[model samples]
Target: MSKSEALGAVREVRLSGGTIRYRERGDGPPVVFVHGVLVNGDIWRNVVPVVADAGFRCITPDWPLGGHEVPVPEADLTPPGVAGMIGDFLERLDLRDVTLVANDTGGALTQIFVASQPERVSQVVLTPSDCFDRFFPPMFAYLSAIGRMPGAIWLLAQTIRVRALHRLPNVLGFAAKHGVPAEVVKSYAASLQRNRAIRADLGRFLRGVDKRHTLAAANKLAAFDRPVLLAWAEEDKLFPMELPRRLAAILPDATIETVGDSYTFVPEDQPRWLAERVVEFVRKHATT
Candidate 1:
C-alpha cells in the first residue's frame, strides 16, 4: 500500500514524552508491533493486513527510534527513554491484554517495557533482534561508534540518500536476505534527511544502547509466566540464530519458531509466514 493509503488509517495520540502515530486494523484482540531503528511502522505493512484478516487487531506505531513524523527532544530519546514512550503509548490508548510484537532494536525496547511495566501486555512475539551482548550486532556495531561522533549521523543521512548506498551491507543490507525495495529504504532515510531532530534522536539512541538493558530484562523475563513466541529469521546475517533457542530457555513459557527464507526483517521477506504464525499464536493465547 502507498503512504497515502497508510495515512488514511493512521491515528495519533500524545504520551509522556511526545506523540506516536499508529495504524490500527481489525477489531479483535490487540497485537502491537514495534520496529527497530531507522524504519517506522511501515515495516509491518505486509504482515499486518494478513493477520488483521485473521480476526485480530494490529497496531503498528511509528516509534521515536527513527522514522517518526515528529521527533521528541533529546530529553526523551535514550533507549530506555523511548521504551518508556512505548509504555506510555500503551497506557494512553488504554489497551490491555496486548500481544507485544517486536523486531530488531524494538525487541530490546519491548523487553525494557515489559520488565518495567507489563500490566498491559499479555503475551510477546519477539522476532530477530539485538540480544544479550550483541546490542548492535558486529556488522552494525560501527553505528553505535559513529553515533558518538559529532557529525557522523548527518553524514550517514547524506550517504544513504543515494539509492545504491541504501542497500549496502552497512545500511539495510543485513536486514533481509534479498534486497529491500529502494522506495521502502527511501522512506526510512527520508526521516533522517529532512528532520535533524530525528537524526539527533537516532544518534543518541545508538550511543546510549547498552546490553545491560536486555541483560537486566533477561532475569525479569524468567518471572513472566505468560506465553512468549521467539520467531527468528533463519537467513539473518547479523542476529545470531542461536539466541532464539537461548531466549526460549530463559523465558518461563517461550517457544521457538524459525522463519525460513528471510533475515532480520522477516516481515519484508516472509510476511505471509509471519502473519500466519502471529494469528495462530494469538488465537491460542487470546484472553478475550
Candidate 2:
C-alpha cells in the first residue's frame, strides 16, 4: 500500500462516489488527520509517526485536490462539502470517539464538522488554518490571481519557473527567520510535483470561501463547550498569527499554543515539537 511519499501502513480506500482518498494506521483510539488544501496526506508523513507511536490509530486522507494522483471532486468542494464528506466517511467507518487534527483549509472544514456533529467528535487541534474574516494577505491575492489565470496555471504546471521564482524567496525567508529545514520545503515540493491532479485540485479548492460556513462554525464554537487546542504558527506567512486569538475568543473552552517562527507547514518545519504538544494536548483533553 506504500505509494510515493505517503508511507502505507494501512490500506488506501477511495470512497465510492467521492474524490477523497484515505488510509488508516497504528492501533488504539482513532486519530484522523486532515491536511490543508493542495497538500496531500503525505504532508503528515513526518508527523504521523509521532501520533502512531503514541499508541493511537492514525488515519490520513488525501483530501480532494490534495494528492498528486487524486483529483479534487468535480462537485463543489467547498468547506461545507468537505465537512460533509468527512462526516460521511466517519459514519461509514463507524469510527467512535475520534480525535481530529486539522490544518489550514482542513481546519476550517473541521470547524464545520464539529459544529454540525459535535457528538461524533471528541477533540480538535487546529493549526495555521484560515477560518476567520481576517483580510487575506497580498501574497494570497497574488497566488489567487495567478492560480485563476488559465494560462498562468498552465505555465506553472508545465515548468518550474513560477514555483522557482515565486516560492524560492518565501522559502528562503522562512528558513532564515524560523530555522525551518530546507529539506522540509523539498519534501513539500515533492508532494506538490508528484501529480498534476493536485494542481487541478487547487484550481477548484481555492475558490475563496463562503462566509456562511465560517460564521456558522464561529457561532457554534462560541457556544460549544468542547476542549480545543489552537496551535498557531508564530511566523505564519499566509494567514495572520492573530487568528488563533480570535478563535480563542470564540471557542468556549480553548487554549492557544504558539509555534515560534513556523509558517503554514508547521508539522514539517517543527514535527517533534508539534507532535509532543499535540500528543500532550490530546492526552489531557481527550478523556473529558
Candidate 3:
C-alpha cells in the first residue's frame, strides 16, 4: 500500500482494459464506491473514511468517467461498456457480498450492473442519480449534441477551462448545492485538460446517454432481490426526488431514505449522513 497523504493507502488494480487507482480503509464487509462524469474517486474523499471507520472496508475507484489519470485506450466507454468494466473490476477483486454505494452517474451505472450482474452486490445505496427520462437531463443535453460534432470533446474541454464555468447552474451547479472547492473543481477537469484521448473517452460516454439505458436497467430490476436503499436528496432539482420512489417501487426489496441539504452528490454535501446510512445498511445486512 502506498501512502496517500491524508487519506489511507492507495493501490492499483490492473484489469483487462487498464489500471484502476483506488483507496481503501478498514477491513470488513466491502463497500465499493463509484462516481459520475468529470470527477474521480476523490468525490468520495469525505465519505469513504467515515464509512471505513465504521468497520466496513471502503473501496473507492477512480473510474474512467473523465477525471482518471490514464484513459483506457481502445476501451469502449459507452454506458453499457462502463458497466461491464465495473463488473470486471468486481470479479477481479473477488469481493463478495459487496455494499455498492454510488452517487450521480455512478448510481445510474450501479442500476445497470445490479440488474445484469446481481451476485457481486449484497446491497446498494443510491443518492440522487439519473433515472429513466432524466438521463443527462435537459441541462446536459447540449453535451451529447456537441459530442456528436467534430472535435466535440476538445470543444467541451475548452469550455470547461473557464474556471468559473464550474459553478454555473448548468455545469456543476445541479450536482452540488454549495460552492465546490477550487481544488476539487480543478481535479474534476484535470484529466480532460492533460489528455485529449481521455476527453474523447468522456465524450463517448456522454454522447451515449439516453433514457433507454436506465429504462432497460429498470426493467431488469426485479431480478436483483437484494436490499437497496434509495437515499435521494430531497433538495435535488436536477434529478427529481420522485425518481428514487420509482426505483424503490420496482426493486423486490427496497426502501426510500430522504436526505436533506444535499443535491445529486450526497457524498459531497452530506458525507456523514451518507456514511451513517451505509453503516446502518451494512450492520443490518451483516455481509460478514
RMSD of each: 1.9, 3.5, 2.1
For residues 118-209, write the lDDT of model 2, one tens digit per residue: 77687888877767653223444454565567755455444432344434543234322344343433433444455565566566655645
- Residue 208's lDDT within candidate 3 is 81
Error of 1 at 241 (Å): 1.9
Give the per-residue lDDT digits (tens) of candidate 1, residues 70-131: 77773477777888888888889989999988999999888878877888899999999887
**Candidate 1 Cα outliers beyond 4 Å, as residue runs:** 1-8
What is residue 91's positional error in candidate 2, in angstroms? 1.6
Write down the lDDT that model 1 would get: 0.81
Judge candidate 3 against the unseen true structure and give its global Cα lDDT, from 0 to 1: 0.82
Give lDDT per model, in order.
0.81, 0.66, 0.82
Candidate 2 lDDT (Cα, 0 to 1): 0.66
25 Cα displacement, candidate 1 (Å): 1.7
Task: Give the 10-residue window scoring lowest on summed lDDT in candidate 2.
Answer: 171-180
Off by over 4 Å in 2: 1-7, 14-19, 135-137, 159-199, 208-212
